[model samples]
Target: MSSIHPLSMASPYIRIAHDFHTEENMRIGPTRIVDHALHYFKEGDGVYTVGNRPTTIKAGSLFLIRPGVPFSFSASPGTRFHMYNLHFDLIEQEDSAAITFPYPKQGEPQRVPLPCCLPDEQEMPVSGLPSSVPLVETATYEQLFFRILQRFGQPNTIALLQSKSAMLELLALLLRQTENQHASSTSDGTYETHLSHAVAFIQSRLHEPISLDDIAKAAQMSKSYLLKCFRNIYRLSPIKFVMKQRIERAKCELLYTSKPIKTIAGETGFDSIHSFYHTFQREVGTSPGAYRALAHSTALQQEEPE
Candidate 1:
């Protein structure tokens, strides 16, 4: 699957979060689905046929099926299958509740399909999502799936918001897995090792001046390869990550300690307090003293009995 738009770009609307079960040896559908769906098989084994292509599926198999896809499921003999099925629209629609399942079921008169019901190649943020994600050993994915189901049927607004949030996170996790899998294939096992070593070196000496040469030395790779790896894996340049870490450390010190801002700046490797103040303002949108004061005020409010 090609890379697609980020999940954060879309406002997803979940229509159904179902816990589905199949009887032993049961066969369901050869029917087309009307909306985008994610099915996570939690138990048993089965054969899922899509557009006449049959694939064996067992517990922990996760599949993404787009609208108008003809699919069917056949359970293996003597075993019942359980699946968590989530149906949603990448973009929210006003009439989402009125959309029917199976679009035009077989033998029914073929009517014009709703434009909103059919998946749009451009508008659907996850059009490039792979048909399946390997979740067999990932408990985090399983928990996120179950979290969607747990909040889906609740009547409270908090639960509804939580279900949407969980779905977004699940989509992000799937995309990350695909990207990591691609990176692993191309990097030959050096991606994680080099990244870890580089990050460790940076973190261990955050109070000292760090340069690209030092990072590359720590990673034992060329500067160009180090840049490419950092961009692909961390989505940030090494220098930017260093600045981020330093700022983060400064923020923690400002919040948790009464140390003077200049002292914190010196300890975090800034060339001077002037440079630290400028960089902190640029990165955090506030002066260090203001941030500390605001944090303290917020903390005092939180500590006050509500």
Candidate 2:
């Protein structure tokens, strides 16, 4: 699995202002929300439309509604909608002028960004948050939602902190689940499961000059079969994939460390500094020194006072 940056150590002041479990046959407007919400359906069914996408919300379903997105909920004709709902915010400090919150009424759809890693399409509509409203169904997840509902009944700091911790845990689980789903969607089940071993082997040995035979043996498949599966799944030869991984590692070293260009090249498995310079320019559209300079300047600018 790819590594995601950890959340900031700054304590996010998350408050659960309202909580309820209701079984009502009703329809809510196509209005936008100003705060993030988590809804876990326990009974009945409904249709929720977020932006332009319509999703079926049935019993055992969980929905994360991002702020500023227009959404509506309508119960099925004969069934009552019963769900546990919680509305909350990740409060920002007063001095944090760089942070902006979304207000749809003011014609701004962007909300305060959350410190998470997610794909572009999955990002919050206009908030720049790392994740969008995702719907998931699982018994274990349902139990977590139930625990949050129970915690809401106790109005105390301990309970509030507990609820916040639980919500963060849930968010992490959802993000990981979504990542796994995306990985699976890119290939067939057999290829997805088997190719993972090869990918891991390559990633782990990126500092070494690994060959196709090595990867095939690690993946427990013949070279020809491995090549076919890899091409079908990743559209790249195993060697190309290894090269890409090496480049990516080199980029990280360049941006995050003050290591010399020659040292970085050697660490990333390049045969010579000349080859590293050529490959880095070809892959990144910049020389190693230029990329490092640009990254440092950007970092410094971001750290500057407003």
Cα-based lDDT for every prediction: 0.73, 0.63
Best by TM-score: 1
* lDDT tens readout by residue for model 2, 12-114: 4344433345556778768765566666666778887777778887765666666566778888886676666655554434522333332345555444554
Query: Model 1: per-residue lDDT, tens digit, 9-114?
Result: 6667788888778678878787766667887887889788767767788766787777777788888888888888888876676666666553555686553453
Stretches of model 2 off by over 4 angstroms after superposition = 1-24, 91-137, 153-156, 187-306
Measured by C-alpha RMSD in angstroms, how accurate is candidate 2? Answer: 16.9
Report the C-alpha displacement of residue 88, candidate 2, in angstroms.
1.8
Error of 2 at 289 (Å): 63
User: What's model 1's TM-score?
Assistant: 0.54
Clashing pairs in 1: none
